[model samples]
Target: MDTLSLTLRQRKLLHILQSHENLITGSELASQLNATARTIRSDIAAINLELKPFNAKIDSIRSKGYFFTAENGDKIRELNRINTAFFTRDDRIRYLAFQLCLTDTPINVYDLEDEMFISHTTLENDIHTLKLLYMLKSPFINITNQHSMLSFEPDERKRRHILTSLIHRHWNYNSRENAIYENEYVSEEILDQMIDIVSQCLHKHRLRMEDTNIVWLNIACTIMYERLSSGYMLPQASPVSKPDASALAASNEILATMERLFSISIPPQEYDEIYLLISSAHILDPSKITLANTCRIFDASVLDMAAEYMELLQEFYHLDFSTDEDFYLTLLQYIRFILAPVHRFSTQENPSISKSHLITELELAWAFQSIALKHAGYYLNEEELLHLAYCISGALEFHFELHPEYKLSTVICCHEHMTVAWSIKRKLLGAYEKYLKVTALIPVNQAKNYDFSDTDLILLTVHKKISDETLGKIIEISPYISPNDIRKLEIYLQSQKVSFLYRNTGSVRSFFETAYWHEDYEFDNIFSAVETLGSEFVDKGIAGREYLSALLQRESLCSNAYCSGLLFQFAMTPAKQTQLSFTVLPRRMNWRNHKIRVIVTAAFTAADRTLVFKLKHFFYRLNKQCDITNAVYSKDELLQLLTAQPDAHI
Candidate 1:
């Protein structure tokens, strides 16, 4: 029987049906194979035709779906084993990619087509897909097909990196048992030995690693062993000076064990690469390790970069992070390994960290990326940015913990009984005790009479029509706070916190009223738009003559375009007064890569942090709620949108 006659999906369907002794529903089979019922029926029909000669068939009952009934079941199992199909396009591409990376000589296209049981066109398409994947995954490595001969870049380090990534990707999707059986490069025994060695070495050095990190290290070492045994060695490069003592010691022991077990001579360059990999893992506890030792591992320039990043963050967030030595050391260590010249480690995606919780940190990470590009000339990817966000998140927690005075002073007013007001206060204190300090509990009827001058916020538990003058400080909440109420409270607290930090006095509507909007405005480019709007602010005595130059300088460093608006701020120093100018272009114009119709240029004093925070939320709403491409918002409409309750928690 020709096992190649059945498609990959068909073979998988056959395997599923063969595993079941009784009847299996077509829907069950469809779900298992991720196919439709009709497709499963078609696949069953195709499989039966292939099995007709062997007297094996998948029969169907009237209503109970299908069952596998074969005259000789062993023949069908043999056929299924022989086919061993690559199920999806991704699977095929991964297989071909590994084949290309492992081979020293170029593989003929026709030879690959025959081996994979695919047509010439299919193989060509797979090659095209592989090129794109490699381009994104490892830009340094190039895949070429000259004269229908397929090969990749000859750099052993890149090849090994790609190989390790592919292995990890596969392991992520499949079970460990399946991964053990499917992995073709490293034997089970050798992988086990490598894992054992890595675990013991890390334990001996008091270096802690996550279980997944242990697997990753073992896989990397196993790949190194295989590559070395095949006579491929990493090219010698400048060694990392003053590598982490703990990681270096651990890498040395791991290498020694592998050398003895595999009977291969691993070079010093490989040890350096392993040291970098371990350092990049960031398993060293900052509390356990001293700053001096950690500082010794990084270059002076990297330490300077870390300091610059912290300063930039402080300036942007209006929060002081100078006293957090642990935060500084963590950022320094990450920057050191990330900026390494050789064997730069790619951060893996951490599924456990919630991106929503890291919104503030993510913003900080974005700013960090801008500065990193300006100074270091490297664009951080999403995963790398996420890693930075986690670090920043920890620092922010520590900062808030150390400085409880930063918390907002609050008074809870309720129209209900005294018990209800106390209940509300309990919930608020339970949830945000760190963020809020409840100053007083007042009844709704007596709320207007009491003095709230010292309180930063007034949380009313009942509906009360607040006067426009005090609306900025009042937020209505339910007696039993809902999640939505919590989110609104969070934003309010963040805005209020920034307001307190900057000593902001203006209302949200007043800030919006100060904005100058130009309808049907025309500009050839972003520079012209900035000049026209910035000069208007200068003419209004809201900004200095250096405002335009500062905007241009910031543009040169990083484009200010975000969402459907170009936000240009002259934050060199606090302005005497705040001014905002907005232009609604008749048509969308290209600003960097963003298609923006709204040009917003603002000159904000250092005390306008609340306005800056609100403006950010306003633009976010402007993008999500309004169709900037076609809809033209009037001044009142824009003001309304700006003052609307923000849905996202700051």
Candidate 2:
């Protein structure tokens, strides 16, 4: 019997029927195979047809489901033994990536097709997908196809890093023991030995690393060891020099222990690679080291970079981190690790801080990433940015603790009576005493006489518009203070408190006017849209000629594509004046993975920093309140959407 005649999934279906004594339902088979019941039914029908020639069939009893009945049990057993598990497209891609990483010679496309039990077209499509998604994006490796043969030219150290990442992607980081047993590249014994060696070396060096970090290091070491054992040695030219003495010592000890246990002579380049890994590991015992000592451990360039980042962060967040030595050291250490010779993939997941809680910090982090790319030729990934945001969030908490005077000074004005004003103030104070300090209570007629200089917000019960000077601070609310009023007040208070950048700046609507709105604007990509908008700004005397270049540079660093088909592009330098150009696309176009329909090009001078900050908060509110995906089409419609009442549920 030709066992290979059946498809992988069909063979698996036959095997399942053979293994079961009692009948199994289609739903049960589908659940086990991660397929729909309909798919299972179709597979069973095809399998029965294939089994007819061998006197074997999957017979179904009414309501009892399927059972295997074979005249020749030996032949059916042979078929079951020969069956291989079905590999999904993603599984095939990973397998192909590993094959490319491990193989030295060019791989023949036909050979791969035969080995994976796929057709030539399937193999080609898989390779194409791999190249487009992974290989083309990789900085350390390149794929070349010549005469139907595929060759991967990769840096040896980077190849090991990529291999470890591939393995890490599949294995559960939470279950260290399970990861060892489940890993396919290295044996469980080898992984165990590697972990023991790393743990012991870290202990010997008094370096208390996180469990996840330890697992990451162990996986990386095991990959290096496996590769070295297979006769693939790191080139001597790739060794990074001037490693920290403690990290180098730990690296040497770990490598020496591995050599003795495995009887393999490790090279110096391998030691340097391990040293790099150790230096990058997040040490939990940093509290033991003083800030001065930590400063001495890193290069002056790294320290300067860290200081530059802090300065930029302070400018954006309006919080001085210079006095916070702990924060400085933490940021310094993180910068040092990320800017190391080899990029270390962080095992940490997205931050535990809620998106709403850390909006300011995340914004600061995003801006930090943009500048980091310009200064240092490296782009921080989303995970790295979120991790940095978490760090910033802690610093913010500390900053707020030290400075309690940053609370918003609020006032209440009621049209009904002075008693009504007091009642509104009482309700607001009851809900947000920590964030708001109710300074005054005035009737609607007496509101104009009140001095609003020290006030951050003015909650009015009447529909009367305030003076143009204090228009931005006014929030119309009901005399009874409804839930919608509370929601609006909460948003305003949170935005004002978190974003210290808000300094009595004019309203976001002030910067955006009907004149700046471009209806039915069309562009090919994000870059083109930014360039065209920037050019318009220059033509209108809102920005300088160099503003276009600045806008392009900022956009090049990282995409500013937000949710709901919106793209926010900014200039690197300040413009002549503050202006926001809103371009509503007639049709949504692709900006990387996002479909961008609205393009907001901001041209702000140094004086408009506070206004820009407030604009960001407004956008955040707009995203939460409006259905930007479907409703926004025209400029008037968008303006109306922005001017609409705040959602009561929010």
Candidate 3:
């Protein structure tokens, strides 16, 4: 399958047909697809004529435009994979990005950097961090990586899955149904190296922080310290001022020293806040940071660091400070931990590159490194600061995640049976339940004569060892391009485009929520409840009908998640998610595989979480249920006769 095979007009026409499938208006197709009606008619005629040999038919309703029957997976794959060209290095990256999204693992920036040899600057501006948009659907797939592990959100996975499915038809479709392991642990050496890099950067670099932000954080911590410590037990009297002619001289001497240190004219108001923080710590008797106090003030991740900072502070200042130093100390700690290791994005890997540009930004952040150092010499060690800047820039470049979207079709070139295809599809759906809105899975043999355009094909699995020859086939056929995925190449093309899931776990989330009540991105997993519920309507084994599930899912194409957020999910299949009853997660006796915190109406056989993304009917139903979710949650309690066995009818 290569892009060279299809004419531009033919590809455009095909896309039009896909969008308006079964009811595309002829006029609309010509207008949207930018072709004259006569030209479109000819294309349609050609398509219809092509269908004849496969014993298939094309339909044009009285008011509708056109629709094609996909007699089998081969027909659909053959119909889409032909004549596509890879054309762009960006396309390769897009492919890699898609694979990252599909994978249930943490991706490494250094690894990607080394593999692609692209500077950190390029990554930050382009494909570095995952977008915060898609959080609900694919939730991060748990997988092991070379360094630093964390969960990716659902929206990222789904989007990548869709995009991956668009190009390489038959990939890992069965992953969603099988056990998805979420443990992505890096080796001790790599993790240590990353930590060491960040530590060095933070110690020497003059970080950027606004005076107001520092003031606020200082105030917040002081207030908390007062409330938590017994220092507030006694009332304090106001201090009386002594009128002394010598005080003026003393003040002049102090001002000179202060100006030399901070490079700012002394202000009484600024000193008041700093004095208050010092005084608060001084008053706490036999002070030691307590874990209970930290829990109330910071998140789990922050609290852990807060305790350590409390110890560091006590050792540095020789004064007691709370383990939870209000929000400032802990906030600073967590922010540092999260952001510290992340160096700023750098344009070169040559290590020896002069940080002239970086120095400029640093100067803006820490003005003292100039005037203070000029007068006091060694104010903050220039060489140390430069090295810190380099690392910070590098870390910033590495911070990244994935954005997930759907694929119109994936050309699977493997010679495997349908089972492998189905398994990969399930895993991909669950993994990408967030971003990928639409996806198509196609086997390999049927792809040689196919065409994939305007399709989100998630390349989930490679049945065989993929070679350059195999990838070339996809390169010539795919339409869209993403720059992050193709950082490297190998025997097989197995990767995903990952969208960053930006979610604030605690206070930050509240602030963000206040700013924007709802985000613009749609999460496929948010509809998981519905998809899971609708799976019941697709029983092919008991019903003894092949393609029943496919037919049911297709009918739901016009829409999913009707109106409400409350969705129930169930798969109507005798060959339900797998017979294996072990949880991939290493938890014992976990409730419903541990991720489901709410009720989603799961059937016994619907073990796969991907059903969350696959079912649309439940989505529509959930919309209707949103209003009385509280009632529905309390339904079991509202009944007058709790013990009575009643009829199934409401």
Candidate 4:
């Protein structure tokens, strides 16, 4: 369908045509669009091109003005794609947030803690910090759980950021600034210091310096190098080569079926180059490992250490890294990421011949993981982590906005009966002044009933249904116009491409099947300070408010993370902090019109406002986690599934 390029007026007419299942008159469309009936008729003539593909036509009987003239699965799919691609910013963020595809977990938390005597709080804070930082630095992002886990999305914009960071950032830090050396060697002092730290830590069961770990120490070097020296950036795919052409061709093939199935075309060649680079850059080719036969990068010890590193990483993230095929790609990517700088540092004619120490270091990480995986660190995976990084970067890149092709006009169609469309239009254009050259708005109903003339795209509410008649009408008059639901419109604009840009939560909900649910069921989880096996207060000196306060303080200092829907409000028994404790209250709730029975948890401090974080996080998660949203929302079962006795409290 030619729906990707329609103007505001034509689109508005299409909207009106579709509003009625029966034939719609041009006069009705003119009334809805607030334009002259003569102008509307001219627009009808202008839109015949859109109806060509389906072998359809738009009709205009003296009184009957214009309506779609075709019917088929092709048209349906075209409407479906248009329906699916219009997601808001929160939608994308939420989409990424709730996708918990981590193959490793728990251990990541522990390792981060083990490094600095960090309470779970600090580790969580670090994760949050990384998220904010990453969002600030890139365009493609994946922030899972708002603040708990992270990942970088496979977006074209992200590829650009990666290229820039690589080209402008350094990769080796254990060197004297600007002091070039032969064969990737660092300053003599740096080498000596590293050797000394390793020797001391290995010799002394523990190091004497401030609490830290090999990973932290290693990070220091990796970050320092990237900062000190510019890394390499791949050539823009536009300056095509054999590689670029090949990547483009491959991407075209992949997109072919999706396009064929839906009758929707993606945003253009930009993605073709990006998909190619992503497929190849991540060692995605099964054959990348085959290159290994040419070089023994490591002996058995290296493999052994990798096993250990994998284990340690598993603990650090409280997730397992080896349980699924997805993790294999993720794992390979991690290994490649961890060793890239080192590999690059090698100056030998056959640098690949000398990449063994990096292998050893990886093995060391696995050594920690090997120490019995924990339930917590069994699900962390690299892509998800990168996803987190991706969101941080994209959100942060808010300051940089410009699109090379395709100018846009935005419409804000909310449920509000009143018109806020003008404000929405202004804000959207202002937000992307770099790319948005024009703007306008109409009452949502009007916008829905009539699209903009040359309105190329739109934003609408999530999961809203696009009926066949309505869609067909739009296609007939303005198949080039893209519809975006207002609720998530802000987010939809930032997406690299839009096959379909509207999400009406009402109708879209059916795409996802419910895993589990209850209409009015309730469950309670109780925790009490009263003791029976032992006296209530045995001078453990950690009972009541004081204990909770200390824990909370530590959490604040570090940042605590809980699985799923929870934010521990431990202040109910604290002193250093105000009285607060977080608990999940699973109850029936509706978000974006989708009903969900969830735990509406809150935290309390004497002075802190009710724990609004729960609501905030929930809102954020809702938009990003379309696929996993149902699952997370469905886990509110109150069954006492375990038989273990309660823990002893003093």
Candidate 5:
């Protein structure tokens, strides 16, 4: 029997039988191997057949399971020599891909079947999967030939990509378990000699490569040259980009040394390909982000675009990231890498397919999209958006670390309404736990009895006459508080004079009056709902004719769905002053991707332009609290949840 023909499971079974001198039950074997008893029986039969050649047999009785009787124990030890079957599926794929890329002619499937210890059926399935998943997806790999034989079609750049991907997956940087030593293709002596020669050449030319990168470069070159020796020359690469002078000098010296070692002359185009791969494995230096280097790396247009994007973020968020030279330089470098012809690395899987997963990234993208299009003439895809978001997140984290005292303290008063007070407290705490804290929830009737020394701001549900001696920094608010209130609270907390974007807290409360909430309005499509609300705004002399058009236009630009079943639909830059309204659908209606249960529309005004950002942030935070929206059945319940005060600062 050929030990190379057995699977890893079958080999383990053989060793198990050889170790036990007493009778072993099938159930016991099954439990030890984590397999079914029926499977154990089948394995026993297969093992018996393989052992027949060694003058051994497993004998079974009616009441017991089985026992092994062999004339010799040495034959059992020979089975361990076949260790190839222990490879993982990815390991097998990498091995197969390398073999196919290096071979001069089509390879027979049966040869791989015997050597890999995999059944022909499993081999065929893997090939089919590789052809569809990798070959078709990549511009590099092409599967060729039919059932009798098959091979990877030859191409220069494509081969490098395949080798690089394989190297990243298998090479252990800290261990000797490297692909060059593991494979039978290249000898250890040859690989070591090549590494010494390449390292000397790089050092002579003042070029630097990390130890692991040098290993990868050596392995890649070994595969290419070995395949070249077998009469398999790679197809010439496409028109080349201008080579870096230092890299070109290093590649030339390396090529000269290889020629002396192997006794073969190299083509100039192949020399460029080697240099290109060397540069692709660049070891980035932190100093490369200097202003002088940034100018050298990116074109003027890219720098201009970065400036405009940073300026827009500053204007909107009032955070001057533009002054952070590292942020600006890094963003410029990332844009250049994104626009490069050939990626530095091989195939990458895309993330950010789910909107809920990348909240901060999506927020930044939405805020930057219009500005980007105005200056750069392109919109950021999810991949680029996530990359930019990381840069911004890092910068923000560093900035916050330096200013650790940025926080807010708040208190609320709603007399004779405990449910309203509790709901308001819950929503505020959930949304602003990172920055704002609620100090107390006081009843207006008992306002004079509570201590108000630590309170930074006070929010009341109803506007009632309270003496200045009793109230401390009080702002009357509606039970259904709007984001405008939050903005005022933030400005006051920072000790800045309130800007035009904010209104007196009493005015904000008036906008949320119960009259503005149209209880009898029929819920239809989003457009119809907006039109019905817009007409009410015009009837009350609060807005003009263009309000409906502006609201629909904003909705079309992006989905107004803030949460799973809630829509925070709002009109931007409306023709008249801002006002707030709400309409609850009697039955669910499809508004874009969301199933609309409630529509909260706001007619935005120029005076409140900065306040819109705060509102957007509020709804963005609400997107994560879908359960809060789903639990509210009546107007009062909704009001209570939205008005929940935050926790007190301890």
Candidate 6:
């Protein structure tokens, strides 16, 4: 029996039918598939005709719509198998690119047409279209011998990148239920093993890494290792010196594991190369980077670039990287990839510009490119600039994540229907899961009955007549959320000036301890000053040794130093008791590559923990002013600055 053919549309119809066992009306099917009722009737007739040899039939009910009935389930299964024969044009093009990338020799166009089940004219058209793409212009794709033959011109590094991107795209598409294709150059088992090795190494080194980044690193390593095993090695532009003892050890461990898995011996220089790759990918111990160690791995130019980038960021946005050791190290590592001789090519188009809050992101990207040109003597392409914007977005998310206690409380009010309110609430939760907490959902009629005292904003689905005070707090929004609405809300949320999440009812002055105060102290480094402050707190019996440990741990993640020579430090969790310490060092001391002279350390009990973040925000505002940081010298001067916010209502 001949297997029945199906177009993609008919296959989609079959999928929708299989999902719903009950009867559906012709109009409902057409609505679901975005077609007319007449078209749906014709498709049903075609479906039933194909099912005639099988056990299945598309049964039509007069009013209730349509349903599929299977007289013999085995025959229905055969029908499905035949529908799987249909392949997309995109699938064929990707397969052709994959084959071209993997093959060492040139491919005949006619042979490809036969393999892909396409006519010679269609194949030629596909090739012509592909050649016009920006990705194929590079050292990767090449057309030779009068455009009749095609070959992948490999620069080992570029090929590895292209191969990894293709593998990831394929895996992401089919990972849910489909089996890995056998024709892939690198098998699933090998990729999985490589991921395992990288995972193990990261765990052993106590490095903090995100899972997405780990997967990317794994793919990159696997492709690079595969290329090297196949005797394709990109020439090293610069010979690598022996790596840092720690990085070398980690790299050697990875090499040993890879050798066992692939049964291939790697050269010694590759050890350092792998270490460089790992570090460049931002998979490293955050605390391990210090002034002494940073110089060893990075050149003077890289450090200068990192500092310049931070300065530019501060100028563009009020972003403070003076004490962000992790960000500095990340930028340092990232610059290597940017400055490397190997040019990166992307087959995919930049689609991030279409996302919500794109205006703000693009503004940031433009600032980034402008700064890069000014400071680093380099300019980023649209794709690269978008990537930088992503990095900035990630950093912003991390900033809020680091302070999860500070969520913007929101209340949704909808008088139309409960479903409308529920739908809006669901969207709010999904969209702002990290930065917002939807406190309550109430109908507009019953809004007065609920407590909205704690809520930051009252979101209304429609215009409402309310008191002037209530109107000030209310923001009218669409019942169906739009991207522009989200952008406006995000901007409004950031601009909101509110009290701390964990504020104490007592005044800020009440949290201070007299014994913890010091004036005109002299210290050349941050470590000695921290130790001295810890001793004072311990002797006063206000905080334990754990408090100092937490403070040091926070510093290790990033410097607590901000611009204009002020340092604000706090722990993630509150201290054993509430004690506020003030230390004033008049001498400019080098701290985390920044000059710092004044330090404020607040140790708050969990009960008064809200004060920590409020104080941090207070310092952030203070850091923006040169007058406060540069002019304040005496305890009274600093006290006046801190207490000036009497209306803060702490």
Clashes of each: 0, 0, 156, 161, 9, 5
The candidate 3 region of ten consecutive residues with least summed lDDT is: 174-183
* Candidate 4 local lDDT, 100-148, one digit each (tens): 1212232244543454454676556555544643554333255454333
Q: Report lDDT (CA) for all predictions.
A: 0.68, 0.70, 0.33, 0.34, 0.60, 0.60
Residue 639 CA displacement from its true place in model 1, Å: 7.9
Would you give me the overall lDDT of model 2? Answer: 0.70
lDDT of candidate 2 at residue 256, scale 0 to 100: 89
RMSD of each: 11.1, 11.5, 28.6, 26.7, 16.6, 21.0
The stretch of ten residues in a row with the least summed lDDT in candidate 4 is 641-650
User: Whole-model lDDT, candidate 4?
Assistant: 0.34
Candidates 4 and 6 compared by lDDT, better number:
6
Question: In model 5, which range of ten residues has the least summed lDDT?
Answer: 496-505
What TM-score would every model get versus the actual structure?
Answer: 0.60, 0.67, 0.18, 0.23, 0.46, 0.47
Which candidate wins on lDDT?
Answer: 2
The sequence of per-residue lDDT tens digits that candidate 6 reaches over residues 386-476 is 5555566556655565666667788898876888888998988787776678888888888767776677678887787544345436778
1-650, model 1: which lDDT tens digit per residue?
35637665676677667767788888557545545577888898888888888888889887677888888776666566421356667667878878888988999999888888889998887887787567655545888889989898798987887787766652422223122114667776887788778878988998876555566677889899888888889998887764478888899899988888778899989998888777667454656656657556567778788878878777766667888888887888778656755333333322212333453455467667656777679767555666787898788778777778878889888988989989999988998887789989888888768776677778887777655445557778888887557867875654444333334444455655667888767787667877777788777787788777767655544344443443434434357687777776767786754567667777777666345555554454355446665565455555555556432222
Off by over 4 Å in 1: 1-100, 103-139, 145-151, 169-189, 209-213, 228-249, 259-272, 279-299, 309-318, 339-356, 363-380, 401-405, 445-488, 491-612, 618-650
Steric clash pairs (candidate 1): none
TM-score, ranked from best to worst: 2, 1, 6, 5, 4, 3
lDDT per residue, candidate 5, 1-650, as tens digits?
45624554555566566667777777557545545567888877887887788787777875566877878765555543343343545546666877786665899988988878999887886787667445854444888858768788766567656765555443444333342214445555666777787778888877766555667677666655665676655566675765568777888888888888988767666677678766655444657568777777767767877777788666755566755777777777665554444333321221312233333434555565655567557554444565566677666645544443443456788874788887888887675554446777778887767777665567777777555543436666667666556644543432211111232222233455543564455654566776777677777777776766656554544445534455666655444677777665556566543556666777766665454444444444444334443565556765665555222210
**Order of the predicted models by lDDT, top scorer first:** 2, 1, 6, 5, 4, 3
**Model 2 lDDT tens row, 57-154:** 88898766899999986566555433233255655776787788888899998888888899988888788777755564544467788898997885
**Total residue pair clashes for candidate 5:** 9
TM-score leader: 2
Off by over 4 Å in 3: 1-207, 210-270, 274-332, 335-445, 448-478, 482-564, 567-650
* True lDDT of residue 354, candidate 4: 17
For candidate 2, the clash count comes to 0
